[model samples]
Target: MKKIYITFLFAAISLFSSCDDWLTVEPKDMVTVDKALTTPEGYTSALVGVYQILQNVYNPGGFVMGSGVDTFANIYTEPSIGFSQSLNSAYNYNFSDTSYDNSSGAAFLQMYKAITNLNVILSSIETTEVLTAEQKNFVEGEARALRGFLHFDIWRIYGTAPDDNAGTSNLILPYSLEVSNEFIPYLNYNDYFANILSDLEQAKDMLSFSDPIIYYSNELLNVEGSIEEYEDLGWYNRQNRFNYYATLGALARVQLWMGNKEQAYEYAKEVVDAQNEDGTRKFRLGTSTDMGNTDLALFVEQLFGVETLGYDDTSYSSYTAHCVNSEYVLNQVYPSSSDIRKMNLFTTLTSNALVYNAQISLKYSLMSENDASAYKNFPIIRVSEMYLILVETAPTIAEAQTYYDTFANSRFDENVTLTEGNLQENILNQYTREFWAEGQIFYTYKRLSLTSLPFSGQEMNTDKYKIAIPSGETNSDL
Candidate 1:
């Protein structure tokens, strides 16, 4: 029996009353679990609270995406002085250090905390009388999809790479499916992955018919309509939630991670080829026009994202505080000055007496004061990633090149060719260019089992790739 330290009873109750502007709910007075679960509105608020917990896990300067995991991949420069000791520790792969607790420790706990909330929702939804059949499907599908998504992220961060055969058989983390203090057993890599796939598949089946994202255009789905216009339902901001396509996208990502290339390609192709009723692409790549308008986060391409109100004012500051190597940014990541990302996604600070010229990412920074909310989204997955998956998993070199060319052309004015020899290298380069500061390049490095990292030339091994389970968790199990 594994005794994981989780605050279910109190934390789950508190989540019901907490409301955010994006969730579009008024704060409720704290009530008992039975009272809260009695209403359909309560279920929605509970789900919204799960998302809020997720924000903490992915919070700026925290572990998962922010500066923490990115440091392990050497995305940021080691400051000359000790400005951010925690970030420095992360860059050095010192996961066991107390200084790094806020990153790895907090993320691990919060992720499970969110999972517990999802289980609480799932446990009550089936028997709840307030929801119609369609509403039940809608809510259950979202909850299950989020459960799989968060678990997969936990596996990515703490467990060994799935390709590592010896590591795959070792017991790692527990896949929490119930809201109880009873001992939950840890699962090995294979069983854990099986559970992840099961949840995602079940969610996909449910969302396929019920989610409005299947029937509406991206424009109509994300519109900021009034509560009266949307009939006071939770259907307005479809992108922020885990909709049908997002479930498919997650399936694609998971399949690729497990090395099921054919299944991965099929799942990714579905997202890339999705269409509106009139035949417009459901989700298109971000264009020069988006760059020109200072839409740095590329709102149109985001398949799934979290809405962090005041992100520009809060998380943006901590994220940009970590600087990048100017030479690496110029020569390796973005070689072409004409590339859209180079032109808009980065800004360089000129040298002064104390420091050399430093390059910083503007991907999450506020470029427009008129509508700062537009830039507040934190992308979890996007259409561009689906295209990249297609490029990697296509049946043949010719087919892969076609997907690669389309994705490359969207970011650069000049034609980017893909040959059989450069296919793998080009894919890596695209990841660095596209996902910098987005907290994905490290996973790419681990998935491919590459020993050396770009820019930093840091040699890697399984120890560096797999973060240690926090001491609190390990101790609780004993």
Candidate 2:
């Protein structure tokens, strides 16, 4: 199916201001809830609207700082170019004051903005009589899950996030249920994760179908479920509703971050169990075909496919910056044939360190057919991710070896086998190839809290992983 996600005009529209700056992408105006969803169809469309924003606004993180021009690359790039920097482990960012920009923050703000859109739908759900109770429950669940997911993202990226459980933090974000101009205290981390999981659990129960719809499986929720796409005539080829499952996947990640390894394992295992054995794991690896390219690059272990919304160009995949544009993570070594990711996602940068040409991307190709050069609803989370996580987090080296081979060999050459003491190394190696340009590397390193990777024969420490909230943030009256 042709993917057509939403896109916002990133014009310089004023936020909390009426300034005429050409850079601000402000809403032309607000519409009442009554008009937005006068019917059931209207309400679901609004949900898709929120999903579109999620896909468009949040791009993945990177392995190292580089030419990507995001905070991700900024850290390594800044320090590499002689800039004094400090690390913030929370976001895995090295945010020296000088490198701050509006891009990453803008994405965070977009997340909140997406939350607001869902909030509007929710506010309407309570009052609208046109939608059924079942529909209302499902939609509300999905909306809450989206909010929790976004807040969770912000919590990870922002240093001092709010928590409903720990109400008395010195710094916290305000919780808004309606349109408001007042700044609120942030929820502490405990409350934050709690609410995020709460939403996911609820949505998982209520989520009748995914965007590419799915069904219950007796074969198990791992590598045994069928790989058929559930059709939703009402969904208009949208996957935002399918986000309920992803909510759980993301929760597993959140739990892992919070150091609840057991819970993380449970959550991840659930995803693995939710897959079909045909290698179409819950979040199966994306073949070069998945990228819609003739090149035979295969990205193994597509844990979760984040739906990609609309775009205006082929210059980049949100992850492109980390792959081809920056340090060239793929060129770090000769990737195996089983590791078809670089072959399909990037063109080798063969410039002898001079011209440095060739691009790493299979995503931007969709720009041509898209009306405004944008794609939509790329999978954000998948089952394959769970298998990989399960293997890495396995309690025993033997168990880890067993799971790693069972899950990984499907993508790598038969020569690949977990060697003694190389379990972690192999896992990280798979992690790198699996998410080469996708930005999960940043999270993996931070999650493991390890420093230094051999890139082109040089040991590099991941600068302390803290992305400084711009100093100007406090200066602004949110």
Model 1 bad stretches (over 4 Å): 1-3, 7-35, 166-168, 226-230, 313-320, 351-355, 367-373, 413-416, 476-478
Model 2 scores a TM of 0.70
What is the C-alpha lDDT profile of model 1 across 1-478, one tens digit per residue?
A: 4445554334344555544311323354233444576777677777777777776666445578766777778877764325666777788887766868655777787888788778878988868899889889989999999999989888888878866753355677888887776556778878888999999999999999988888888788667563343445557678888889999999999999999999999999999999999999999999989867767878789888877653443334333366466655555678776789888877665642223566767776663334644656778899999999999999998899888889988998346677778878888888888888788888889888888887778898988888788776663535
Error of 1 at 76 (Å): 1.2
| Residues 1-478 of candidate 2: C-alpha lDDT, one tens digit per residue | 1111112212221221321211121142222334456766556656656655655564433112222223342222122222212212122343543433444445545666676666666666778888667677667777777776666656555533112223443344434344434343455445555667776677666664533334432223323223433223143222334444566677787777776778778878776665544545444444545545431222223333444433343434332233343334445543565455555555544542212554445533443335342233333454556767777667776776677776555555345556566767777666665554444565565456454534422222423443444443433443
Shift in Å, residue 466, candidate 1: 0.6
Error of 2 at 171 (Å): 4.0
What overall lDDT goes with each candidate model? 0.77, 0.49
lDDT of 2: 0.49
